[model samples]
Target chain A: MIRFDNISKRYPEGRDALQGVSFHLPAGAMAFLTGHSGAGKSTLLKLIALLERATRGQLFLDGENLTRTGKRKVPLVRRKIGMIFQNYRLLFDRTVFDNVALPLVIAGHRHQDIARRVRAALDKVGLLDKERALPITLSGGEQQRVGIARAVVNKPPLLLADEPTGNLDPELSRDIMRLFEEFNRVGVTVLIASHDLDLIARMGHPQLRLHQGRLLNPEVLAPPQ
Target chain B: MRPPAALRVYFLRHVQVALNSLGRLYRAPLASLMTAAVIGIALALPSGLYILTDNLQRLGSQWDGGANLSLFLRHDVSIEQAEALREKLAQWPEIERLRLITPQEALAEFRQLSGFGDTLDILDENPLPAVLALKPAAEATRPEAAAALKQRLQALPQVELAQLDLQWVKRFNALVDIVQRAIWILSALLALAVLLITGNTIRLEIQNRREEIEITKLIGATGAFIRRPFLYSGLWYGFGGALLAALLLALAFVQLNAPVRELAGLYESSFRLHLLEPGQWLLLLLCGALLGLVGAWIAVSRHLATIEPG
Candidate 1:
């Protein structure tokens, strides 16, 4: 669902964040973006999410040109992609249920539909019992699950996670990876950025590895097995 | 037919956000009340001045009908000559009506009012002069017109002195005009002050919720969605300030009404202090709320644009 044609991003201070990166992951494929810290993994995902614009070349999502999309249409495009952050990014002041309902609320769904979908997503993430509990009271892994529930509540076709399991223990990290695999089995495209080589090797997902702002394996189009 | 789903969602979202903003204000009662009190005092000053000027204008206009000129005849002029002069002046178009008070009538009035009846009887001759009390026509009661008529009467050969009794009324009207201008200036400045206070308050709120705003934007929340709550907060501040202002105005009116009425009674006037009409109060509230909305809008547009999901 994502195609980057020789995309290069240069910061205003003349530093290249990504250089001549080209890749394509067909629809219904899940992959890992493996790179060292500051190896431009986040930048690639940001380009796909339209969080940062490419300085050169073109990028496309679902056959639509993202590089040509204007600022006003960015929100509409973003609604099609679910994003999870390493920090969980949950509003600590709100309850778990309220946190998960945010995406549906932003989409202006009917209140009843929002409640049903949010609960279903929470149940999937094993957070049904913590719906009314504040995120501050939840464990790290639980908080990450709340973030996962929020990202999936709207049923976006593409999911992007930036080191989502970075703060969890190995067992909890494995559990989070399993949840992503479950979503992929149902035909949702998933791209996760991470430096956890051990967990990624065990997961056996094709890795779009990057090195020194360049993709080391740009032609790895293997489907998720 | 029931409302469309999108419309219902939009309306419900607004109601939710508005109530949520109000609840936030309730959460910080002291700070909100202090800000609203400042706005209230600012609004009340201009409102009170406006009412005072309006009442003063009404009082001044009430005395417009009493515009009169008094012409005293020369001591050497006989009553017949005085009567002839009065008849001649009475025929002028500017004179609505004129009454000639001869020396005897003047002396009698002075004696009755001055409380010097025995002393006045001790004098062999009366010192009073024939006076013509001239009431100008309604149109000629204007200050300039009456002044011109006074000058003409003073130039008459039979008249020794002429005085326009409407001088004080003209001065009072001028004073009222100046005060009205001052009120306009004050109101404009205070309105600006209200805008700044609300803008600053909303700016701080946006800063406090910066993380929430960034996350909301990341999750595809439109600019309008992010702006709704801040705008509602501004509306609440404006409405609360206006409520407090209205209360202050009502209290001031209550405190001053009795004394004002007593003062008017002392002058044999039936004038009473009047408060704002219902529509005027409604307008003040509307203006307050509008100012708050505009202020919040400005702050939101300026700050929200700079915050992106980096």
Candidate 2:
């Protein structure tokens, strides 16, 4: 679903976040991206989400050349993408249902369809009961689940999560990882960026390791545990 | 054929979000009302001043009590000569009409109207002078032309002093013109003030919801969708302010209407003061709403571009 030919990103402040990075994740495939802090993992994910553009090279997202995409078309391109953040990034002032309903709302779905899909996504993440609760009132794990539900509510063909379980305990982290696997199993391409080498190794998905803005390894593709 | 399902979805979502934000405003009555009141006050002052200026302009133009000039002939001028001078002036193109009022004629008219007939008749000799009352031509009715005609009449050997009744009208016209200009300038400045106030309010709202905007952008919310609520907020602010201003003007009109009518009646004039016209009221509302929408749009475009979910 994503192909990058030596993508490089350099900020105006003389910081080179990524350089000579290239990778391809086939449709319906799932993979983990492991890198240290500032290892260009977030930058790569941003490139995929169209939040940040590659300074050099071409990127093909679902066979569409995103490198030539105009700013006005970015939002339309992002419709097929679901992005998650380490902070969960849920709107704290809103309830769980509202947070989960955001993607569908952004997609301009009808109210009934939005409600049904949001509930179903929340149920999938095991947080359907907490729909009316505020994000501030939820536990760290439950909040992350809410984020997951929000990400999947639109049923995006591509999912990108940056430290999805960053704040969760080991058990909750495993549960989050399992949720990702389940989505992947259902043919949604998933790419997760994390610094947790052990958890990623145990998950047994293919790994794309970034070191010093370079793709040191590509496509581990070990069978799932 | 049925309409596209996507289009139906979009319409429903728009209604939903717009009503949602409106409900949000209703839920927090005090703060919302405060903002609206500020907008209303800003709009009301200029509108009231403008309406006042309009009525004053009407009154000023209606002061055409006829630009009549009275010339007191020299004491020694005979009634026949005064009559001859009147006849000569009557034929002039500048003179609309001329009447010779002999001393006795003036005295008799004064006595009948002044209710002091006996007192005036007690005098041994008539003290009133022969007077020539003249109305200017249509083109000479303007203040400058009337003054020029008066100057020419004063140069006549038989004329003593020329009194132009249009002087007070000239002064009043000048005063009204100044007031109208001042009101227009005030309206422009206050309109700008309204724009800034609304823009600042929208900017602050965007700042408060920065995270939400960023998240929405990341979730593929289009530019129009993201801007919809803020635009509506501005519209509400403008509309609410306009209503408040209209209400204020109405109240002011009510309190002033009776006194104005009584004053006009005292002067034996039929002039009546009225509030803003119906068309004017609609225009004010439209201007307010338009300003609100523009202010919000500017703020959204400037700030929303900076917020990205990276």
DockQ: which candidate is best?
Answer: 1
Query: Candidate 1, residues B1-310: lDDT per residue as tens digits?
Result: 6568778888998999999999999999999999889888888899999998888766765563457789999999999999898789878999988989999999999989999999999989989999999888766776888888999999998889998876675886678778888999999999999999999999999999999999988888888888999999999998889999999999999999999999999988999899999999998898888888888888898888988989
Clashes of 2: 1
Task: Give each model's whole-structure lDDT.
Answer: 0.90, 0.86
Per-residue lDDT, model 2, residue B178, is: 89
Candidate 2 docking quality: incorrect, acceptable, medium or high: medium
State the lDDT at B36 in candidate 1. 87
Worst 10 residues of 1 chain A by lDDT: A216-225
Per-residue lDDT over B206-292 for candidate 2, one digit per residue giving the tens place of the 0 to 100 score: 998999899889888888888999988888888888998898889889999999999999988888886787899999999889888
TM-score of each: 0.84, 0.81
Each prediction's DockQ against the real complex: 0.68, 0.63
Q: Model 2 Cα displacement at B293 (Å)?
A: 1.5
Name model 1 segments beyond 4 Å from true: A222-225, B1-3, B64-166
| Each candidate's clash count | 0, 1
In model 2, what is the error at residue A135, expressed in angstroms? 1.6
